[model samples]
Target: MFDGFTPEHLALLRGAGVPAAWPRGGVLMRQGEPADRAVLIETGVVKIVSESANGYVSLLALRGVHDLIGEFGCLDDTVRSASVVAMRPVHGFVIAAPRFCALMEENGPLALAILRSVINRLRHADDQRAALGSSTAVVRVAQVLLELSERHGTPAPRWAPKARHLKLTQQELASAAGTSRESVVRTLRELHQRELVETARGAIVVLDPEGLEWWEPEGD
Candidate 1:
């Protein structure tokens, strides 16, 4: 969303909110909470999740720098449908609902940019659901890793200068993959055996992106 913003629009948005920060594991937004404010992330990552009545939490998506979260509930005048939690220490701005709406009403371009962003988000969600329904556990896990690598990965000098490190926990990876942590562990082990990746406590290093991208079960 911020990527599409014009300089004037970005300035307007940044000016509307109060700067804030959240520690790792902080709850930025709670599911079912009353609509109040939206956050514009400037640094770090957050996980969006929806919980079932029986306490089953489904990981919805990950948002990072320049993403706006909690806007949907504020836009539609509804309670929050999901929770946003910080995956790392986060710094951003908190814009109250009324102010946020005012900004949207007064700025046509900003509103249009936000609308396009929402549409893109929905499309991505649809594609992810379709992939989950059709893909094997290993494939799903691999896809999640690839996405994390593409989005948040940085060079891991501790592993190899060229290796890409994905900074996330195994359970987070499983949640994103729509599978069990055990399954993710097994999948990572296999990837390690194939020399495609290396895992530590809370990170994974992509040793071979090309191999991982084209990899499939031997018999498949």
Candidate 2:
């Protein structure tokens, strides 16, 4: 979405918002809350989740730098459908709903970009649902890791040469993969044993991305 904006348009969007920051574990927005504003994430990651009536929380997606959240609510004039929690310390800007909607109305290209982004998200949701129904736990976990690496990974430090780090927790990964935490633990243990990844307290380092791509369960 940001890539589609012209410099002037980007400046306008940024200028409309006030600067804000959130510590790790902060709730930027909550489900069922009034849709009053949209957040433009300038740094760090956040998780979007929805809680069911039975108290089950489902991870819907992850948003990082340059991502705009809460726009769906703003667009539809409805309450927030999910919660946005900071996965790490986050810095961003908050644009009030009216301003955001006005900007969209006045800017054709920007509106189109946001529309495309929404369509892409819907498509991704559909694909995720299909995978959850058809793919094995191993496949789902691997896919989630690969997505994190591709979308948000940073190269590992000098001490971990040729590796890449993903800043996400095991529980979060399990939620995204639609599996149990124990299952993710077992799968990650297998991955570690195969030297495909290294896990720490709140991060996973990919030691062999290519290998992970080709990895399958031993008996598969």
List, residue by residue over 5-31, the lDDT tens digit for candidate 2.
Answer: 456655777998999999999999999
Model 2 Cα shift for residue 205 (angstroms): 2.0
What's each prediction's TM-score? 0.92, 0.91
Tens-digit lDDT string for candidate 1 (9-112): 66787899999999999999999999899998889989898999998888778888888889898888999999999988999989999999999999888999
lDDT, candidate 1, equals 0.86
Model 2: colliding residue pairs: none
Q: Which whole-number lDDT from 0 to 100 does residue 165 have in model 2?
A: 90
Q: Worst lDDT window (10 residues) for model 2?
A: 1-10
Q: What is the lDDT of residue 66 in candidate 1?
A: 85
Cα lDDT, model 1, residue 25? 92
